[model samples]
Target: MNNPFNPSFGKVPNIFLDRAHAVTKLSTELQNPNSPYQTTLIYGVRGVGKTSLLTDVGNKMSAKKNWLVVNLTTNYNVLQTLIDSICQKSSPEIKRLLDKIEGIKLSAFGIQFEYRLQELTETNYQILLENILDKLQAKNISLLVTIDEVDPTPEIKNFISLYQLLIRENYQISLIMTGLPNKLSELQNDDVLTFLLRSARMELSNLDLLSIKHSYQDTFAKKGITISDDVLIAMVKKTKGYAYSFQLLGYLLWEIADKKITLATLEQIQGEYLATLGRNVYYKVLQELSPVDHSFVIAMAKAPTQVVTTAYLQQKLDKPKNYLSMYRKRLLDAQVIKSPARGMLEFTLPYFKEYILENLKFYV
Candidate 1:
């Protein structure tokens, strides 16, 4: 049988955990004219389901008759891509209206449009987008733009500035963006993008342990397989309630287990599980950190408890309290580590300490 669990990034899995609350809140707010959620930002660590949650919310809104959802990526001119996406998804009547605008020609190749200009200025792009929004508004259609993996680029800043203007003009337009915490922090600090600081921020957290357990039990039962309570709990604990880990462990378990799961089956996948996570998530996470940030993380990894005290870290790194405090706030803003209480810190990703310990030589 095909694997029911999907460990791939950005792809929604067959047996997904229900984040109905987040999905509902965003979908409902976007439909409301006065809701502040019209512009929402979702930020989280890698593989914590930021992209998946954004996709789910977009899909929910797109199902409505009056909603036109357009997904954009940061790899190109965002404004041009927005126009192309809007035109592609628009109805035939709306397409004709947009095509009638001078200098904007809709290509016969699936509604992609070309602007007759050597270079499109910010003002020019805004005017073109305003014209299109006018057409969409005439049909009483609300536009929802979803951009994944947002970064602080000139293209993004330009698009966001225009987006703010469109919002002020009271167009039936909304934007939802997803990015890593550090990337979002960078965007938030941009003077031109200060409007983003006011956006409704949703920081994705780890899944509930109970929820993860139930999802596993239900999924295994559907496959006519049974897992003892002990073995099931052990498997769930291994996932650490992180979304990607849940899927990865479930995918591995589904492939190796037969009609019944035993502790032995769980034992078989341990090496592969940790190794895969290191390659897919941890390595990339480390690459994003600076040399000092590496030292901070390494210091925390040496703590006996998952939650490390600030005093302990200060002593371990042999840095002054003030010096360590700067890195503490930096990591907090990056969401690499979170403070569970005053003068304490902990890694946001599950099994991160173990991953660090296993690869200590390279990091050192």
Candidate 2:
């Protein structure tokens, strides 16, 4: 059998685990005509599966007959990308409508047309988009715009501002954006994007160990493989409930093991596993953090124990307790660290503390 596991970041697994509820919630909202979640943001650290979740939900959403899912990336001009994606739709009806409005034949055959009227030659994006929406909504269709790894640039802000206007006019549209906490936080500071603050916030948390273990066991068994109980437990523990690691471990193990999982195989892939996490998650996360936030991570790393006291963090940074609060909050917001107890702190990402220690000189 071909490999069922997909380790590449953002590739949705054939069998997704630990996020059914969020998917169900999004599905319900997509089907509902009036959903406050129309403007949704899925925020998480790298490898926490924001993209996977977005893909899953977008898939479920686009399955409906009246819904159009436009999956986009932040690589290009956001507005132009949206326009290109919409125009690039292969649906016969969508192509027909675009051609009818633009007075240009756009289809697989070839582009051939001229303006039937002088008035049709000049059309703005807003008018063209609104006309497209009007045509779709007239047929009781809704648009679902899903953007992965969203960057909150001026272009994105402009897109949000325009989208907010569409919402005010009661357009049948929904937007789903996935991004790191730091980039998402930038949206919160933009006055134009204030409408987005009211949208549903689904922060990706660590997958539960129980969910991870059951999924691994069931998926392996389906492929005619039986993993020892201890190996299953060890696999889940090593994954630390991170979503990408869940797939990464399974992919690595499936390659080496014949019919059964072994500890030796687990030990064999340990270094590549860590290096993958560093390349995929750690570097991306640190690249987005400000200097102050890096200092906060370094200070926390210097603490003697994993559970560092808040007071100790302040003293180590040689800053007043109140002054240190900003960085502390920044780290907490980024999900790099969590307040385990009332006053205790610890890194949330598995092996993050080690990654920090190994790269302290650069960050400091």
Candidate 3:
């Protein structure tokens, strides 16, 4: 049977686990133009399923009556790209509105019809989008803008500003974006887009262990693979409740398994695929940290035990409690680390501590 595990980013998984409440709530909000979550920021470190949640929410909303999903990419001229996307995916009724937008004519033709159509400027992309939004609003239709991989880019800032204006005009639209914690921190500094700070925030975290266990078993059984309970538990433990690792482990294990998945089958996967999964998911998370946060993380990794307290970290790094507190909040916001108690900290990703120890020299 083909491997059911899909490790690629942004692609919705075949066996999605957890985040049901959040997804359902966001889906319901699509019908309410005034939902506070109408402009939401779904953020987390790499491989935490931010894109999956964002995409799933968009898909659910698109299925609703008279709702449209406009997905944006990190390309030149975000406004122009948005204009083109709305034009392309819009219903015929909406298309009539987009057909009147000016500058987008130059963008849509991409020099192919430059001779027939006069070159136009994109300064009024907001006007174009507002016209489209007003037409849809009249028809009682709404638009949901889903953007992935947010960064501190000029085009993105401009896009946010434009959205702000449309919101003031009461166009029926919602903007959902995903970004790393640090990138989002910087983006919020833009005075014009500072309103994003008030937007609802959904920080993606690891899946529930029970959710992973059931989803894993169900997916495997459907493929005619008899997975023992012990092996199933071991697989979930190795995945660390991360969505990406869940897919990676299952894909590798299925590649080598016969009709049954035994304890032996789980053992067969450890040497190479396990390390590959760690590097793919864990290292990228480390890169997302700021230099100070990275140093703080390395200190926690070198600590004597899995759980470290703020006092212990302060002593280990010879820093003040205030300094540790600041980085702690930063890491927590990034979802790279979690606080299990009043002051105790632990890495959120499974096998992450082990990975840190093995690469301490380079990271330090």
Candidate 4:
């Protein structure tokens, strides 16, 4: 049988788990014109399924008759991409209406819109977008713009600023954006983009262990593979409820095991699993951190307990409480670590401590 689990980054897995409620909540809010969740922000650490959740929400909204969902990325000019996506995805009638706008020209090849003035400004893009939105609103259609991997680029800031204006004007538009927690925080803290601070925020945490076990059991059973309860629980704990780890571990197990799962097979694939995770997710996650942040995380990994106290970190780094607090907040904003309780901190990623220790030479 084909492997049901997918470990690739940003690709939706065949066996998705633990995000149905988020999908439902966001989709429902987008459907309601008066809902505050019309502008939603989804943030999480690497491998926690931010992109997948955003795609799912977009798919749900797109399935509705009146919702026109346009999926975009922050890689290009977000405003132009949105305008183009809207033109392409619009119904023939709506497209015809948009084609009537001065600068927009619809062709069988694709949308070709131009600025009447040679020098284009933010106002030009805003005016053009508003015109298209006007037509969409007239037809009682609501626009849902889904942007994945959001960054605080100038183009993104401009698009978001225009989005806020469109919202204020009651254009029947909604936005759902997903990004790494640090990047989203940067955008929210921008003086001009402060409106995003008020948007509905969804931080993708770890999946529930019980739910992961049930999913693994159900998936393997469908393939007629037998795995005992103890073995299954062991495998689930190995995943530590991280979404990508769950897929990666399941994929490795399915490939290595025969008719039944055995600890022997799990043992055989352990090195490959961590190595692949470091290459795919952890390396990039580390690259996002500053050198000081790296020092702080390494210190945490050196601690004896899974949870470490702020005082311990302060002493270990030989920095003052204020200094440790600054880095702590940085890591927290980056979602690299979490405060389990007052004066305590823990790595948010499963197996992250081991990853940091094993890769210490490169960072040091």
* Cα lDDT listed for each candidate: 0.86, 0.80, 0.79, 0.87
Ranking by TM-score: 4, 1, 2, 3
lDDT digits (tens) for residues 38-154 of candidate 4: 999998888899998888888888888888999888876677778889999988988899999988789999888676566456677778889988888888999988888888898
The best candidate by lDDT is: 4
Indicate the worst ten consecutive residues by lDDT in candidate 3. 110-119
- Cα error, candidate 1, residue 245 (Å): 0.4
lDDT pick, better of 1 and 3: 1
TM-score of each: 0.94, 0.90, 0.89, 0.95
The root-mean-square deviation over C-alpha atoms between each candidate and the true structure, in angstroms, is 2.0, 3.1, 2.9, 1.7
lDDT tens digits, residue span 221-257, model 2: 8878888889989999888788888888888877777
After superposition, candidate 4 runs with Cα above 4 Å error: 114-119
Candidate 4: lDDT over CA atoms? 0.87
lDDT of model 3 at position 174? 90
> What residue pairs clash in candidate 4, if any at all?
none
When 1 and 4 are scored with lDDT, the better candidate is 4
Clashes within 3 Å, all models in order: 0, 0, 0, 0
Candidate 3, residues 285-357, lDDT tens digits: the string is 7776778887899888889999998888999889888888999998888778899999899988777888888
